[model samples]
Target: MRMFWGAAALVMVAGCQAAKPADPAVEKAWVRLPAVQGNPGAAFLTIRAGNKPLTLLSVSAPFATRTELHESMAADHGSSSGAGGHMMTMAPVKQIDVPAGETVKLAPGGKHVMLYDVAPGVQPGAKVPLTLVFADGSRMETQAITLAAGDAAPE
Candidate 1:
């Protein structure tokens, strides 16, 4: 009867609806190649948040002895006039926030993940595994390809 047709229509409509996408997280992660061993390196990535805001807790890499989230800031050299060379320094940060439905980019000369004391064996054309820990106790694993020191960022 009419009730049976109504139920069939409802089921058809439900079946036609597309499934929702998976949770958003990190994407397009890459690590800049280091000039030499035992030197610092930088990592860049974009964090896409889901319904709730995401906080980057920490970063870990196999090539580096220690890895930490860091931000670069311009230093004030006690110069009232803007006539001196700008000095930049990097400092450790507890967490980086990625607002809901937004992407936070970690790039060179800006906020980035700092890798200290990189191993000598880690060379160009190598694949470095990076684990990004979030505040929600979720972790995303990605691979960063090591490029030449003079090479540009991956497209």
Candidate 2:
């Protein structure tokens, strides 16, 4: 009888341990809206990683003539005392890393997607399909709703 009770307790403890939930990581990602028909447009997305680092490989959109990952950097002030800052353009982002247990934010004056020569016929209030590729060979597709033209840079 003593052995039987001990075995039962062990089995109950094992069951409780197995009921733990999975880590909520890299499952929820949000991409901000992209600019349209205003010279150059930008796309912003949010990435979450928990206990595992993630890489953003590439992005594709239907309405853009060309899409590329890009980042904006403030130009070096002539004497580090200039009031108006200049922007120093750099190459597109080929790979991005998202640290574990944090959210990577893509915003204006930071990391963003640059769309050159947006395709015609893409109108406001329309949603464009965006496919994001990951380093693990997994892809996630989401619809990025369009905003009115000349909305300016994204946050």
Candidate 3:
């Protein structure tokens, strides 16, 4: 009887150690890019996960050699105009918080991913598939369509 109890305890510990982490559930995602002409760069949509905290490991797209996370900022102090004033700039964000029943959006002048050096001749109406990996070894895929240059984002 003692031997049986000891064996069972060891098995339970082993099982716990071998258990795999669960994947986070993605709620919604989107992206933004100029339509008329493809630029050297592009911005991606924010992601919102349902009821779980997950770390974003990396992002990839076939259209570009490398995809980097970036943020855009509007200079508030006339920095662009050569005033040398403090610019209201937005920098790249490392992580995002996804609260339960709420969504975290990566919008213009905010937290977003930057797609650099796109494939030659990428045009509007093209769909780009992006794969996002999480820290728990789970992945999510999203497709973003190209928008026309000067086109306003949908409200």
Candidate 4:
């Protein structure tokens, strides 16, 4: 009947529709240009999770040939001989967990993404691309505003 055909058409149309993309889980993403060229730069951001936890597996930026996750920890003394007082140690980390309904900050002197051999084009005032890969294999594409040394926080 006509009603059956109409229902079938509606079901077919709904099936053809694409699923809505996932919600954005990143905010306040920005990159800090390295003080010296050829040195590693740093990227900071805040990540939020929805009802389920999300694991940030890795981050990638075109400006840097190699990108990795790292953490800065304060220890009693630095390995360097000249380090008299407390020194900060940085090491690579595998992943960062963003609990449900929680926010994790990737800021200075904490967990952050290290961009190695950053390209010269990624200078101050430049907007670069950053991709965050989660544990579920879903990738979130985002852009980061570059900041120079002594530059104020990005708005």
Instruction: Report the lDDT tens digits of candidate 1 across residue range 39-139.
Output: 68888888888767889899988788888899998887756655675777788999999987778999877899988887777777788889998889989
Q: Write the per-residue lDDT of candidate 3 for residues 1-155, one digit (tens) a residue.
A: 99999999999998986664444544334445534234445555656664567667667778777766666676766566666765656555565555544555766667666776677666666777888877678788887776555666545
Tell me the deviation in Å of residue 96 in model 3: 3.2
**Model 2, CA-based lDDT:** 0.67
Q: How many clashes does the backbone of model 3 have?
A: 4
lDDT of each: 0.83, 0.67, 0.64, 0.87
Report lDDT (Cα) of residue 62, candidate 4: 84
Model 4 spans > 4 angstroms off: 1-24, 78-84
C-alpha lDDT (0 to 100) for residue 135 of candidate 1:
87
- What is the per-residue lDDT of model 2 for residues 66-124, given as tens digits with 9 covering 90 to 100? 78888887667563555565646556879878876667877666887776766666666
- Candidate 2, backbone clash total: 1
Q: What would the C-alpha RMSD of candidate 3 be, to one decimal place?
A: 9.4
Which should have the higher lDDT, number 2 or number 3?
2
Best by TM-score: 4
CA lDDT, candidate 4, residue 18: 39
TM-score of each: 0.78, 0.67, 0.64, 0.79
Of 1 and 4, the candidate ranking higher by TM-score:
4
Better of 2 and 3 by TM-score: 2
